[model samples]
Target: MDTRRLTQYVICVCVILTTVTLAQGQIKRCFACRSRGALGDCKDPFRFNSTHLVPGVKDEPCASGWCSKRIEGKKDGKDHDLAIERQCLQRSPPDDKERCSEALVGHRKIFICFCYGDLCNSASGIKPSFLLLFIPLAFQMLSSRF
Candidate 1:
């Protein structure tokens, strides 16, 4: 192979390898928050009550302690905030609802799956927020490459 061509090939290979390895593999935790401070994650996001997010949306947040998932995807956090806020109302104290509503939208998405009254967002691969994470990453990676 030509020397210059070989180097170019090598670089291309490196880039592909690196990018592919990180290509949206299911993390043991939420892709957004990665279970760092999250109480848990929602593995399956849609099983909840479609009418009520906390019940319909997977990995919704806890009452006062932690939000089911976090948001840091490509979508503007501001946008998802509206949806999260609407869902946040389902919780106990309806006071700080506005800001609490902002947790699930933006360049991120998290869903903590809990079984019986526990943090569910950071649970693991089963969380649906993981899907949103990849959806944007797919778009982002494509855009940057293009």
Candidate 2:
């Protein structure tokens, strides 16, 4: 192939590779569980017991690239029942920060945290990796050379 044609071919391959790499980061496997009354293993003080199987608790792929854990209950009472839910987010939250926020849904108050990365919604809170941020910049620099 000619020099120009070869350069174009190399650029095409690089673009394709970058796209694939970026897409891979968006796919995450997160713990999925929901418990209303019994508290089970889904509540705070989450026990990640792999040896003993727990019903309604498992890891599943999150297509939205975000996972969330939500706890719902009354703010004033210790005796009030609390609900815990961990699942893949249907859509990305407004803020990308990996932190917890308190919100009221009707009469019930909830504390929810959203994060990106595999199983990042665990008891440790959000675990976002900043490494993925450099991929696009690197690709841009590479393409500029051509």
TM-score for each model: 0.20, 0.60
State the lDDT at 49 in candidate 2: 36
- Best candidate according to lDDT: 2
Residues 37-120 of candidate 2: C-alpha lDDT, one tens digit per residue: 655667767777333438778888888768889988753455237788888888887766667889888887789888877777
Q: In model 2, what are the clashing residue pairs, if there are any?
A: none
Q: Model 2 clash tally? A: 0
Clashes of each: 46, 0
lDDT (Cα) of model 1? 0.34
Maximum-TM-score candidate: 2
Judge candidate 2 at residue 9 and give its lDDT.
69
Q: Which stretches of candidate 1 lie over 4 Å from their true place?
A: 25-146
TM-score, structure 1 vs. true: 0.20
